[model samples]
Target: MASAAEQLAANMNFGSFQKASELHKRIWFTILAMVVYRLGTYIPIPGINSAAFAQAFGGQSQGILGMFNMFSGGAVERMAIFALNVMPYISASIIVQLMGTVYPPWEKLRKEGGEAGRKTLNQYTRYLTVLLALFQSGSIAMGLQASPGLVDNPGLFFVISTIVALTGGTMFLMWLGEQITSRGVGNGVSLIIFAGIVAGLPRGVWQMFEMTRTGALSAFAMFAIMGIAVAVIFAIVFVERSQRRLLVQYPKRQVGNRMFGGDTSFLPLKINTAGVIPPIFASSLLLLPATVMGFLANANLPAWAQWVPGMVGQLQHGQPAFMVAYGLLIVFFCFFYTSIVFNPDDTAENLRKYGGFLPGIRPGKRTAEYLDYVLTRLTVIGAAYITLVCLLPEALIGFYKAPFYLGGTSILIVVTVTMDTVAQIQSHLLAHQYEGLIKKSKLRGGGRGR
Candidate 1:
């Protein structure tokens, strides 16, 4: 069955896609949603000077905010409503997922709860998103007021307006993501980030060229950077697709007059099971506080409060503290998120229930233990790969003035999302083709039932 499926997939062509009406609609809807998102990024927040805002963001563009600006498709640089991006939702998701590991109620909901339970959890995520948005946006407002010529008028009204606008923008993005997942292609939230990262590619290239033109980067160094980027891209694609497969053997069974014989299958575990989530979560955890501080550096803070922002500023991108925290968090989340998504205990239980067992392993607890052992090793390697990819560029950036968007996280997101989206499209096309064949078979049957 697996071989035949692979053969069928290999046979896919443009003709099949052209015949896929449902897929066409989905693709168009996704494009339209992404376009809307891009347009909104250009829409400046009210009572803000676009030029000054851009200038201020540029001044600090080498910090975490610049990394975030790349993720928001320059929205943060513009101080647009979407400057907050969909991060609040992503942060909320991380919180809820982490809670599931410790909180009994959440554990129950995630493990045994049906679709209804998932919906309930989703509702909780949205609530948390709003709360996070409120705090972050308010801090951002304060920061904006502190920057000279950035805000037209700075006061109570500006703070109130900024908070409302930023929060509303985040909520809208969360809703838009859901709509895209349901009505368009899947992985809506990831795709939003993907679009943002991709949108900055041309600009990053231009910035690289400028560095060479200004003699800060030699022509040899520029070509070397391009070469390194291509190599990194290849590495990312290869590792992301690699998986560890465990073979499961199903025992023969007798059902009535027929012998429901044994079968074998493989359970594939992806190397980077957490996808781009670890970096997003880690970046959010570190950047949220730093962002508040960055904004408040010029704010009317007392002397004690004044030094806090200054201290935190040292933890910005490429700093030792930032690097250590980022790497550790990525490793932690790699294991944590992988465990959340793939539970060995549950997998063992399901296998037992289905009369399946892994070769050379017991059917229950032992099987679970074995799976855990294998996964832990895989997770370590995956985490190391991710960390190296993300942090290796930081050192280079400090010296050569490279763009943060060129880091490993962006490459992972772009590659994984593109692969997943394409797979979904192909699945839809395959389903449509099967339906057509079935209809033709039914018509040729001359009213005789199978």
Candidate 2:
């Protein structure tokens, strides 16, 4: 028999969505926030010579700058105030999370400090973000000054102004993401990144078509690329939804005249527990070093520092070193993040406390070990899948000069974010249906009493 929630979900349709007034408002607010983000991407930082910078960017578009630009929705290409994007925040989050695992105090805060600890950690992340933004923006400012004709008045004033603009832009975006999470549907940070990638999809498609028209990309190759992309998307959806269900059984118990427990359930473990996080983190880590190298290559350096340009070249899209490093990072983060998200020991403890145990496993240490073993195997497969999906774009970009939209990371973000947002909408509709049922039942009961 279907439960009430399941029945409500089954009855959901377009009409139900229409009646979801709160969902509509949230969706509208999300759209408006995205519009604001897009607008900010077009507002260039002060002191940049737009024409000169655009021309210069054209040559470097195939490098790290290009990837960063894609992530920023062309903000980097335009030298906009928001050129830094929320990468600093992401990096800071990575640091904080890592610390939470290794540092005893942080680990205690994470494990037992409750909401207050989480807030404190968030404050720390914000502070770290500001510091990282300052460093990165300063590097970019120096790079801009180094390149002739890129800046209108290359001086300390310009550097200070650029850093202020870029850092402020980043902080504003972080705040905006928080607001969206509180008031809108879906994850605000992921949605911000998703919006950026989606906004550039049309341009990417047009560019691909343009390449085909110019004979740079053959018709057969274009079709093959599209087919591969479709296949990848399908594969992602399948893998993301795949789960390993561990059967758990609770022994029967009785209290007075009532009988309880003896219920069976399945503990579902997702194959890709890390989701799109591994790819995003990998990309951010790789981009940071490449960005610094690219900037330093333009700066006037000592006699021994001339190798910066060579290193930058080697780190460009399609390079063997870059591809290998990217794959490794993806794999590392997959396991690392999965461990952080799901603790087998905690799971075992909770199950034991509730008198629930895996069908064939003991309820304590053995269960924890078994769960860890299974999770490890699943993470291996998950890592391989993510590496393959993410590396395909690098290969295409390196060999065929494919558009950035063809990249697996972008597609993953788009698809995953879409799935999450849709699920949230459905949940909202389900809640609304429950409310309706309760109201109807209340009126009927009141009439009977009368």
Highest-lDDT candidate: 2
The sequence of per-residue lDDT tens digits that candidate 1 reaches over residues 1-450 is 457567667778998889889999999999999999999898878889888776767767888778788888889888888989999898899899989779999988988898978988999999999999999999888888877788998899999999998999999999999999999996899899999999998888898898889997889877876776677788888988899999999999889988885989999988888887888888878777877877666567876676866666677677887888889999999999999888899899999998999999999999999999999999999999888887776656655767776666677678778988988998888788788778988888967764
Q: How high is each candidate's TM-score?
A: 0.95, 0.97
> What lDDT does the true structure give each of the candidates?
0.85, 0.90
lDDT of model 2, residue 138? 94
The deviation in Å at residue 408 for candidate 2 is 1.2
Error of 2 at 429 (Å): 1.6
For candidate 2, the TM-score is 0.97
Clashes of each: 1, 0
Winner by TM-score = 2
Window of ten residues with lowest summed lDDT in model 2:
393-402
